[model samples]
Target: MTRPGFSAVSVLGVCLLFTLSGCSGTPAPAPTTGSASATATATATASPSPTAPTSQAVTPSPTATAPPSSAPPSSAPAGPTETATPTAEPTFTGFPEQTGPLTIYYVAIGDNGVSGPMIGCGDSIVATTTAPVRFTDQVGPSLGTLLVNKSRDVGLSGLVNVLYQSNLTYVGGELVGSTINIYLSGQFMLGGVCDIPRAKAQLEYTAMAASGATSAQVFVDGRPIDEVLSLK
Candidate 1:
């Protein structure tokens, strides 16, 4: 039991120092697992981000509308209706009265030295079935005998006197057997009785018509016209 150099106090000190050094050393960290990393990624994916505010679209309404045209404008006026005028009837004004009964033909000058018979209407100039006019009562100035009265009836207008003179006299007519004599007393003789053939023909025709004789004789100024004018 006798240990020489080793004392009890030295051994006890060395053992206390070794116990203090072991208590001061740090401990090792634990290892990470794959399940813990997957859990954290899923938590971030499931969470939703904040949403932006929604904008509403606004539609505008029309302001003006056009009017319909069923009729004409109010500024213009309508046209007037057309009407027809009535025609007037004719009236008889200046026509002469048709009196008497007989119609006889007498000679008168026409245009351009022409001569023809004109009608003379009288009561006693010529004979008719409805009215008989005695030749003795046929006297004085009348149409176709002395003066042309009804000129329009023979295609002439107004009064036309072939024997026109200032102071002429028609000395009546006389029937001497088959020959008829008509007398005249005036300076206004028809073409000197011979120089004018138209005048001679007119006198002869008038004389025949007046007396209704076969041969017509003319006497001017109490002398026979044939003897005065030297007519064959």
Candidate 2:
């Protein structure tokens, strides 16, 4: 009986002490655990790329330039040309020597084959053979009279086609009354006519001066005659 009564009192006292100790020793509950978080960061680097190779352009060569001219480049000189002096046209420096144009006065007295003659050319007073010169009213009863002067008497005038051409004419002469006249045509030597003889002329006369005068004597190259000559 005694033992049971003491245990109840002790058990009550021990319970009250345990309650006070627990209140004092307990720590504040860990702050609500903050939401756990972990963040990761990444960094990147860049490098430059190499450039491609390029090709170069080609150049042209220079050419030589020519001199300016009206025509073109040349080695010839420009100016008056040197011409050979036209050889002094083979001159006639002395007697009987002929060069440029020439004219001569001739007389035939030394040669004997020439004498009085009556003659005429178409529309021109030519010469007179050994016959009286026929006169007419239109021709005024007289063909021109002859003179003894050289170049003053009747000169040979006719077409070169019918007379002198490509030749030299040498003439002999004499007097007729108070007149001088040529009986023969010429003393010409032409390359074309040399081989051929000279042409002869016809003589027609009827005393135009004194009637019944001596029938004039005709002559050629100095040969006296009383007839007309035909030249062919």
Candidate 3:
């Protein structure tokens, strides 16, 4: 029954090839180990491990402070104070004593010619005296002598005592510094206008010469001699 050019030997050879193929086991699948390792690496990169929460340290800010003062303390004690003193003033004394024959001035007539002709009327001269005198004791006595009337009887010719009729008597005298104060108590009488000058000159000049004073003033009845003598 081989028909048509096909032979039994060809058919047997084909069958033998198929049988050999069946006896060998199936081939192993391709390895996936590399793919699995790649997948695990990707997962690890995508999901990072949770990191522990970090703690922060806190630094406090610096506090402000006040500066100290340069002045001294108020509790200390104070120092002492000083005071001043004042000065004083000066005083006065008296004059020296003198003694000798005294000179007395009296009013004279015609001594000054027409300018002052009558004695005691602005005319005068030093009268003569034989009696020695002490200057200290003569001030009262000298003024007393001028009160005597009648100059011709005392050898003083042309000299007039205008105060003889006034009844003025010499009191005590005081020598103060260079001045002599002669006190008199009396009634003041002048025979006429000419008698006034004669009275003043006789009293004042006698007082000065007797006391050796630079000036003299007469006081009568506790008043100035000029006031009393000014009577009309």
- lDDT per model vs. reference: 0.49, 0.33, 0.69
Q: After superposition, how far is residue 172 of candidate 3 from its true place, in Å?
A: 1.3
lDDT of 1 by residue, 1-232 (tens): 9678867898988888898878876756654677667876787678866788679776788868847665566677545545779778888573343434443333333333233333322111111112444343342222234333323233343223334331345676777897777777664433343224433444555455544577867777898765655646
lDDT of 2 by residue, 4-99 (tens): 465777988888789878888868876443422211111112343466666866677778785675654457776555677766668655333222
lDDT of 3 by residue, 1-232 (tens): 8568758999999999999888875977876999888888998899888988779777888888746645444566434434666665564443445565655555565466443334544465545453665544777667766675534334535555556557778888888999989899878776787767767776777888777888888899888877886755
Residue 12 of candidate 3: its Cα lDDT?
Answer: 94
Cα shift from native, residue 204, model 3 (Å): 0.7
lDDT head-to-head 1 vs 2, winner: 1
Error of 3 at 21 (Å): 99
For lDDT, the strongest prediction is: 3
**Ranking of models by lDDT:** 3, 1, 2
State in Å the error of residue 149, model 1.
7.9
